[model samples]
Target chain A: MSADLLIELIGVGKSFPKVSRASDRLRALTSLLLGRSPGRVSNVLEGIDLTIHRGQSVGLIGENGAGKSTLLKVITGVYSASTGSVRRLGTIAPLLELGAGFHPEQSGRENLRTNALLLGMSPAELAASEADIIAFADIGDYIDEPVKHYSSGMVVRLGFAVIAALKPDLLITDEVLAVGDESFQKKCVRWMERYLADGGTLVLVSHSMYHIQKLCQHAIWLDRGRIRKQGDVFDVTQDYLAWHEKKSADTGIEHRLTANGEYAVLRFALNGDTGTLPIELPLGEDLLVDVELRGRDDRAPVFGIGFKRVDGTAVYGTGSEFERQPAKRLAHGHFAWRLRFPKPSLLPGTYVITAHALDPEGVRLFDDLPRTVIVRGRTPELGLVRLAHVWEDPT
Target chain B: MNLLISLLAHFVQREIRERFLGTVSGGAWLLIGPLLTLAAYLFVFAEVMKVRLHADAGDSFVVFLALGLWPWFAFSESILRGTTAIRQNAALIGKIALDRQLLVQAAVLSAFLIHGLGFVLVLIVLKLSGYALNLAGLPWVLLGLAGLALTAYGLALALAAAAVFLRDIESVLAQVLMLGMLLTPIFFPPSQIPARFAWFVSFNPLAVWIGCIRGGLLERGLPDASGLVLAGGVAIAALLIGRFVFRRAAPHFEDYL
Candidate 1:
């Protein structure tokens, strides 16, 4: 492990024993006493080969329970790998698990001392850097009080304060910047920018793609204990987000199909076509959703369509039942439902369009289908839906 | 090794200061708390129980009891604190890449040092009251404290490691130590034990250490040659074994947490 290479993990793997019951733990202990292998194991990380260089920031992007945290631990030397070798160079400051080293009974100043010294700082070094940490924390009188009395945000401030002051050669953090108020988070981002500019390396893991795409040059997408994809930040994060959208839509469709009631949704498509699931369209363009349903008998049913961000934040929803327009049966036991938006005016992002069949009153939902759509635009202004307006100047 | 010791010493200072941060008296309470315990024990054991060990050694039972039991108190306090040191500082263990033994050693040693402070003053007062004071015994006094400290660190390593994996060990250790006070000659003298069980006292590590110090303070000089050798051997052995157990257990500590 040379100094310039920072960190190297060659085919690293880690396994944890699966002990759920008291009897299982006892059996494991007995095997150890008998010098035999313990039963059942689950691998949390497998065959990961990654090399991070100095002054390069890499982001780990994946869905929840994707083993991102386990990889970070392996790199930080907290948990030894069960297979292969891990060699790391340069000093490391890990901002893993917020307030991880802070003792609630001790004051912030005291915790600062213990945490810094544990990070390998000498007493003289800590004393010299203490003022910078205190000023950055900005907790004032709370720095002297026991940390148990501190609010959650104050604890985050103190934690970030220590990491920021150190400016270590390699900074490995798992969502430490996600805490605090927005302005403080922004400040931490600015400080991180400066830190990276000074030729520091970073291994960052966060759920926010905006932060990852902005801060990291390279990204690795982990799935089920393996590297799903590794490439530029923009490509990897976009792939990860797109996968999330597809998975959610698949589940929603599965729910509608499994219900299999008298009324059932047969096919759902967007843009009057089926070329791709998330049909691409420009902003301020028309979006058409078509839903085919089969009813046990010829009865008018309410049809509704709604749109939401890929993350499940609602953008716009409308039901024909609200407009008191019941669908008419075009054929025996089969009805065609269509909703059209002449101009969506949606901001540029991935979105889900859900079409559902309901009773005439719209109180009871019988069957539903969901499909994802991608909106493209060149607008600089931010938000879910863009509204048409003309600017006027007062003279 | 130099770096490790300095880091250990740093943790010890933090442990000492953090122990009494909230109270108005702050660090002063460390001295006062042990002194009060001494006063309370002297009243109950000497005046109420009316027990005496070696008549040739001294006239005051409180003096004899204080001299013999101070080291044992150091041993007890250390194990009590050390047993839970790692579990109590899970935040520190998971976040920092520190030598885990350093945390246990610091907790145990700080407990010894604070109690050792009170014992040093008690020895001074005894000398002023004209109780056969000799500089030759000072070496034995130092040796006895070192033995107790080493033994405490060893026991702490095992107990703290065990407590992390098996949480019940903490409560079990507390109960065992409470009863262990009777096994050692703290409240009463070793002579009170029956002849059949007298070997238990001689073999008990804390009893052996107290005897070593007693030999130096009130006697001609030095403890029994064999007793000093035996006590030092146990202390060293415990330290070695404790280090092994701690090292093996340290890697999986995060998994348990």
Candidate 2:
């Protein structure tokens, strides 16, 4: 309610009924009459609190099904909160679902009027701004053609142009930049930079970390419908990245050997052969992954090592198969295995190291270590994956 | 009052644009269905059956037909279209801040406009074939439009509010409109009905409104000034009832939509 804050949300939450293709309308009605809550549906957002001030840009990041879109809808008044309040000091433009107001049968010229009217512009204002809208869209003769004939890219072009021209007080963008080609995406980014320079406020939701780090001063990370962490963009983003890396390293991981299925993995460490930490690795330094596994059965054991990028992209993965290493036969006791990489060639950002143990023939035995380790970048534009290449000139 | 008039103008323009987006045949296409039905009925009664029941009691059969048919068509279409207007534009209701009742008003106004044009064409035909327009009949057109606006507001609000929660109410309204067309005195004067059924025609409000129009154009003057007052009362009552229901139902629109 303060004068400086343009948007304020206090304890806002929302839930949607889960619907499947098999569930028909009649069943939905019958369930409604019975006054029993449906089993499958779950909450999409919960207990969200945030305040956005004038000229501040905030980024929203989350895993899939983490309620990013739902939060944007609540912020823009598309969906009223089930509980709590959302207060705004100025007009809001939810560019949430782009071209949602477009009618296919109408021409682009005519649809501009419809779009402008919905955006609170009167007919006379629309008429006055029509030329500017057309020029910005850059779709010369296509503006007079029916929108149904338009390609999807053309529609986004026109829709984005109209909204950008409006210069609303608060702009809410929800993955709209994911449309169109690479050049259009760059154009949108440039326009956003200009908008920020002009002191306009923005709430952007996207999965691109580079864009998030580039544009946002603050960020909120949502997990299963609640704010998991929020603060300066880099600090929260780094924490979130670290947490996600650790999580991906843990699931479906294998470990080995005890009387019961309760072997605890202890003393997970990655270093060079000389016991140097991963961060101190030289150009061709020996990289060693060391893990200690203890469990019920210890007769046949296999250990595997995999490395992946921050975005969950696998750069390279190697196990006993690729290394030509056989299972370490052992009695019921604690044991350790060391996997070595001749030269760690990962270029940048964040990388994860996961160790799993399986039976001699490759059935999962136990989880050992799922730790994330960062790879220092030697230079910009080196990219995340580094491959050795030899350059030669013809004599 | 000014706000309401401006709202009406906004919706009227929207309706015109949405309904007739392509080529403008002066919206004559909307009359095709009713004219076809009229021709089919004339064929059955005049050419096939050679039936002439109580034709001598009144004026020409077709003029009597025009008086009853046109106004009834307006009301029937208004109710039918108005019932589904909100549901058909769920996006607008779900996303925009425009008045929800405007959707219903647009439906009614568009139907009224089309019917008014049809009425003008029918009058032209009547005059060419030896019928006459009373010079003093201009006031009735104005009165009819006023009554239509009031009555249309009520029907639109009532049906739109109900349709939000009860999904089947739209079809129910359509069927009731069909039944209403038969109950109202559209093709014949109320005097032709028996005394016991007199209340059915008199109490049925559209019967009086249509009777006024028929009296003005065909009878060449006002038809029972008291009847106009009664019609106005009913229209006002419907408007009040519809507005009350609409306000009560407004809060639940977003939840259901």
Q: Write the per-residue lDDT of candidate 1 for residues A253-289, one digit (tens) a residue.
A: 3343353666666667787765445677777889877
What lDDT score belongs to each candidate, Candidate 1 first?
A: 0.78, 0.70
How many steric overlaps are in each model, in order? 0, 12
lDDT of 2 by residue, A1-395 (tens): 36778988999888665555434333443444344432344688999999999888898999999999778877876566766899978767777666676768778987776666666665666678889889878888999898899998888888887887778888888678889878777877788778889998888887876667777888999999999999888666766765676577556453433323444454567773222232433344567777665544554355667776645677777776557775443446465667777777765456756666555555655664555566542332345656678889979
Give fnat for candidate 2.
0.07
Q: State the lDDT of candidate 1 residue by residue for B1-257, as single tens digits.
A: 66677789888988888776668987677567766777888888767876665634554676677777778888888998898889887877776777888889889988888778878877776778776655677777888888889998998998787676566777888678878888887777676788998988788877778876776776643456777788889999999878876766676677665
TM-score of chain A of each: 0.67, 0.66
